[model samples]
Structure formats: C-alpha cells, structure tokens
Target: MYMRNRTLLPATPERNFQMTAKERREEIWRLIRSGLGSQDDQARATGFTVSRVCDYRRLWKFILREHPAIADGVTCEEALSLAKEQGVKTKR
Candidate 1:
C-alpha cells in the first residue's frame, strides 16, 4: 500500500495487543486523554477496532472532558509518543 492510500495509516509502527483487560482500558484512556486522534484513531493505536472505539467513545469523551487528569501524568504528546514507540498498528 502507498501512503496516499490512507492518511491515518498509523504514521508509526505496529505493536502487539498482548495487554490485559485493565491495561487495555488504561491505554484506551491514555489515547483518549492524549487527544492525539479520534476514538477510532486511538482504538487503532491501541490495537482495537473502530467498533470498540465507538463503544467507548461517549464514556471516553466524558472522562477526558469532565474528569481531566484521568490519564495520570501522561500528556497528549507523551501518549502519542508512547503509541508510536510501541509501534501500534491500524487494521486498515
């Protein structure tokens, strides 16, 4: 595939989704709070599907907006960097 094929083509590498449920949630939260991309983008980064992103989109937005500081100390840049570092994949 070429870069023009997909704009949000992960821009990074691909990582494994070998995390526990708790870890997955945390990553999802991190991605959400990161504000790097939309829920679908985050889901793809965290090794999840767009459907999963849709499922938690509302709640995730609530937490990110209403709660704040939910991602612990992980900043948006940090979270995005971590995703890139982990080589997260987009199943497109």
Candidate 2:
C-alpha cells in the first residue's frame, strides 16, 4: 500500500504520557481554567476525547461554584462522592 508522507501532516501538540493520574487530571483542569483553547483543542492537547474534557470542565466548575472550600483539595473520588450526595447531573 502506498502511504503518504507523515511529515506533511500538521504536528500534534506534545502530550505528557508519564504523568500520574492525579497529575494528569490537575493538568487538564489547569488547561480548562486557563482558557487557552477551545474544548476540542484542549482535549487534543491532553490526549483525551472531547467528551472527557467537557466532563472534567463541568465537574471542576461545579466543585468551584458549589463547594469552593473543597474545590482545591478534593480528589476525584471525593468529588464524585460529593456529586453523588448533591445529585449533580452527569451523563455517566
């Protein structure tokens, strides 16, 4: 099969695959809060699909807006627990 030259395609932003789960999550949150890109762009930068990016952004916004005290300190598990207790709507 004839393959096109890979170099001709636009380069993707470098993504850090070595980060721990927490570190990666924090980075995604930072990217979302930084307002440096659109949802799709942020997703691409973080190596996440757009839906996951949107989900994280929504969860972060909810935590900040509704539970400011715990927003910065809460872990993903804790956030999910809080969301469950508060009946926060989620797609999954």
Candidate 3:
C-alpha cells in the first residue's frame, strides 16, 4: 500500500507589486548595512547587481535628505512604516 502526503510547500509570494521604489531603495540600504561594508562588498554579499547597488545608493541619498532619521540606523521597514504613519505619498 502506498500513501501520499497532502502537505505541500507554499509558494513564495510575488514581490514586484508589494514594495514601492522608495521601499525597494531602503531595503537595499538595509542589506548594505547588514553586510557592514562598501556597496561592492554589500552587492557581492547580498547578490544585488552593481547597477542596482548604484541605484540604491542614489535613492538612499535622496531619502536621507528627506528623512534624516534614516541615517540614524532605522530599518527600511521602519522608515516605510513611519512614512505611512505621516501619510506620505510616493510620486508617480
């Protein structure tokens, strides 16, 4: 007699539509900090492409100007949450 298990691994949810560009940029910075090094090193460790790393850095600079608290070691999720709490909207 053969028995089949009904349990199956759940599929990963799609990430494309969930995070906005700002959120994505913040996430990249978080990855960089989590690695504790330069963009090149962070990219290597996080598996992000060099071009993506550059974009993240540029976006991070812009975000930092708008939100100084981000530089104070706030997590990307926290930053996004704070922005939401403040009713900030992303530019289209």
Candidate 4:
C-alpha cells in the first residue's frame, strides 16, 4: 500500500531544502529505524543521494564517546565487557 509515516522523511525539495543538517540526520535515523528498505532505496525515496545517506551513521558517533566513566570506577575493559554482555554490537 506504500503507507508509512509521511512525516519521517521529507520528500519535497522545498521542505528538504529548509532542513538543517541535524534535522536531516534525524530524518535519516528515523528512516533507518523504520527499516523500510536498503539505505540506497531509503535515501532515494527520501530525496537524498545514496552517498549522503550512506554516511548518515557518522551523525551517531557521539554514542561511542559515551564510554562508561572511569572516575566512576568503571575501567575501559570493564565497560567494553559490559557492552558486549548487553548485546551492544559495535562495528569497530
């Protein structure tokens, strides 16, 4: 039926042109979270280039920096082990 949350990804050039980089990033995140299609398809459907869409995950790098606090007595090894135990699959 082609029905999805229309507001998730902006299709109009006018609206997309008005989006800030942060807004664009959020839209891409929403699109990926919905898992409607491959990144290329999602990008094309959302009026974005495949290259730009493929690089969108760079916007989420901040989460990696949120490693558990060492001052709180959590070592890097301990944090990594905990992350693995929690099923947090990091790609690097």
Top candidate (TM-score): 2
Per-residue alpha-carbon lDDT of model 4 for 1-92, expressed as tens digits? 12344333345666777887656655666665455666655675556677766554332332245642432444334444555676665333
Q: Stretches of candidate 1 above 4 Å error? A: 1-14, 64-92
Better of 1 and 4 by lDDT: 4
RMSD of 2: 7.9
Error of 4 at 73 (Å): 25
- Residue 90 error, candidate 2, Å: 4.5
Give TM per candidate: 0.46, 0.60, 0.43, 0.44
lDDT of 3 at 70: 52
As for candidate 3, its clashing pairs are none
User: Would you give me the overall lDDT of model 4?
Assistant: 0.52
lDDT of 1 by residue, 12-89 (tens): 333424666666656666556445576556756667677766545544443445446654565434444444565543
Stretches > 4 Å off in candidate 4: 1-9, 45-47, 57-92
lDDT of 3 at 17: 45
Task: Give the Cα lDDT of each candidate.
Answer: 0.51, 0.66, 0.53, 0.52
- Please give the distance, in angstroms, between residue 64's alpha carbon in candidate 1 and its true position after superposition: 5.6
Lowest summed lDDT window (length 10), candidate 3: 1-10
Return the lDDT, model 3, position 1: 15
Give the C-alpha miss distance for residue 92 in model 2, angstroms: 3.6
Q: Roughly what TM-score does model 4 have, to 2 decimal places?
A: 0.44
